[model samples]
Target: MGRNTRKRRTPLATKAIAASAALALGGGGLIWANFYASAHESNSGQNQTKAAAGQVATISCPDVGQKLTNVPQRARRAVAKELANLDKQITEAYARLASTRQAQTRDANFVQNSIVGPLKEKRAASLDRIRLDIQRVGGRVNTSGLGSLAPCTTQPADQTNAGGGQNGNGGQQQGGDQQNGDGQQQGGGDQQQGGDAGQNIGGQAGNGPVAADFVDITKVAANVQGKPQNGGQASTGSFTTKCGVNANKNHNTDNVIVAPGVTNGAHHLHDYVGNQKVDAFATNDSLIQDQTSCQNQGDLSAYYWPVVRVQDGTQDFDQNADGGGKEGNVGKILTPVQAEIKYVGNPQSKVVAMPQFLRIITGDAKTTTNGLANANAHWSCTGFEDKVQLTEQYPICPQGSNVVRTFAFQSCWDGQNIDSANHRTHVAFADPASGACGNGFKAIPQLTMRLVYEITPPTLENGQVKNAYAVDGFPEQLHKPATDHDDFIAVFKNNLANKIANCINAGKQCQ
Candidate 1:
């Protein structure tokens, strides 16, 4: 065997050495490229701090065997695909992170403002989970310990288009290969549907009173100022009719003109100039007092005559204005000296169905040493002799049954606050005025009336009532006839009452 054996070819050895040398060079180059890429992308300046971190240089190598050598191309393609997937995941994570940050900021602001509660805490926890996911991905990138030339058996497939623009084998896969596609599609569809639904929701809003300048007189009667020839005493009451097309089912309210009568039976027996009384009576019988009777319509205080604000379809205000500003945004009240009532519907003099009963409480009475110093009396009059139904001035909502909720009303004298050393004393209108003993009388009847109109649940916001008044009427720009009192009151009362009722139903107690 020794005689037959020949020395191994030096040329073969040389070729083997060359191949090994080439492999070493390629491996070193690849590792260098990988490390360079990582360093360049590192947030902590990995290139500059590599020595401090005790990290070795990196190089990439492919299998040498023919069967395995085809791996570089496969590996390159896989790395590209994995990188693309990672990019997509990172993008989604970043978006989620941004949302979480925004939520956190809002929660922080809420907590600062003392608005944070259990709901806010739960939201914070959800955001924290998203943040933790971001941190976890970051940790993997920073703490991985694979060598530069190490071959990753589980390397994700590459999805890149190389020079030939060819994708890897089985790269044309579809369907389940795409992750979260179904979820994203569904989410997008739901978002669009929700937006469409929101667009369909309707609301009622106005810059100011809906019908401010409109007015109408649906009825009228002659006033002789004194006892009639038939011995029928002169009175301050009128009948009315209203008509309208309720297109939107909005609320409405109305008010009527008032004529004052004497507290005594005689037309002009005693006259008072401020605090002093006059002696003689006027024989012309042309004298008329400006007063009101039938105060406190049920639970409500009183409905104002000249100008009254009806809210949510149930309550009436003695004053021309309500507490809140135009849209009822602020909880502020301002009492106005005067107001103008505008009829809501029926611009033409069209007669509508009128209320059946008409009741008038005339302010007339006599006073004696009966200890009723600030007390006044009223006479309930029904069925006027003149059945004339001319439209100009008439009682709109006569004989309407109602209810009221009474409680202590303490308003700031200066409208600033309920408490302050400079603030004025709080007056309880329910109680008799202080110092009422010696100076004739110190108490005045402060009770008022607010009208209520019965309505169904569907009529209101899903049918809820918290306030005594309802307000309904025409739009703000419409012009109404000058003779429609009934229409105006009906609209205003319905609108105002509904608002109060809704507020009450929502757990806000009446004041």
Candidate 2:
């Protein structure tokens, strides 16, 4: 198939043909009926385009001879069992293909290259295996049905019910001559599992920020008129806690939330920096017990989020490209030059322990267009301070300095909930003018993260560099450099929080 050629109607057409055969056979007919009806209903519009493009093909099931009258009863039973297994496997392969395809938003080429092609190969191999098994049983296996398998060409019209159904068992002929028994494939088993799994897989590809009311950093910065207030002079003691290199152990290529029960995480890939063991399935209680890579053994906090990809143009990071999703290549996973933990007294000059299970988010992951929402999602250079800007276009840092990404979370807490509905309501930024907590809020130790990367200069395309760095993000954002964001969760025990508080309040710089 050509790189741009699409096979959108093949899978559905195949399903429809299979359903017709099931109806004729009088077993498992309802299962196929339901599958065909759902698929057709969801993709009616796309089907019209598929028909016009002449991409749909007619598939016919071959006439495999019924159980041989002269064949031994035992042989008949064995063949029936083998055939049933093959049918089940074929059904499952298509079901999985449908589910995965629905989740993707990449162009036709990408579906053909990365996803559809591989799935087709697996199905073909399974069919071949089934043919061999039938030959061993002195039965002739018809291979005519194999020609219709093809790649998906068109994008699905609606994905609301993408992973809704499960593959049902194909009805098995009990005895060679007897009519096929009415076998009802169990429902609610695999369908529920697939739906839940789809939900847990991360990287939702869509337009702009997920939240409707996200605040831009530029606006926040502009609102502040004076230097950040430290409230009052620090007492005599202040302390610093440093966490050692906790390289993200769960370096998952699939960006889905793997936390227990929550399977859907990120759809696009993300570089998880801290808490090596962090995954989609991680929980507050589990994180508190996990050992810290921090030098301070008592601190067991977890911090992680998506990664930044340094795109030297020509790389297929474009979301519009055929066979492309977000960034085309996985890109390099840059380690932070430095990772540490520190607690500082809030503007009130009072250091209070952070509440356990506190979940704070810094920067907007969904800010694709607005520059203000990405103010704190900073990108800077070691020497070129004058070139810093809030736009998605990143400057080519001078030869000496590497690119730096700094994310700072809110420091004031509401003192009640460990986490709010939006992950930000419980915490608010300190007053830009006074650097003090708001009326109902209390000052807590501040958490800041700095991720440094050694990005090479952009590769020129047609005598000009168009896009240099492509940060990982939703497909709708086009992998724009500005959508970068980070997350932090406080899992410190009360005793540890108190120690951090004492260290900051006492004005001691202890690491």
> Candidate 1 — which residues are off by over 4 angstroms?
1-108, 111-426, 429-511
Measured with C-alpha atoms, the lDDT of residue 157 in candidate 2 is: 18
TM-score of candidate 1 relative to the true fold: 0.17
Question: What is candidate 2's TM-score against the reference?
Answer: 0.51
Report, for every candidate in turn, its global Cα lDDT versus the true structure.
0.18, 0.40
CA RMSD of all predictions? 40.8, 23.1
Which candidate number would show the highest lDDT if scored against the true structure? 2
lDDT of 2 by residue, 391-478 (tens): 2334355566666665546777887866542344567666544556675787787776656677664432211222234465533233
Model 2 backbone overlap count? 50
lDDT tens digits, residue span 1-511, model 1: 0011011222422343344334323533322111111111112211110101111111111111101111222232233222223222322222222123224343634322322233234333433332343344442212121121122111101110110101011100100010000011101111211121121001111111111111111112221111112112111111111111111121112111111121111111111111011111221121112111212122111222111233232212211222111111111111222111111111111112211111111110111111111111110112321221111111222343111111111100121211111011211111111111121111111112212223211111111111111121111100011101111111112233343333322333332
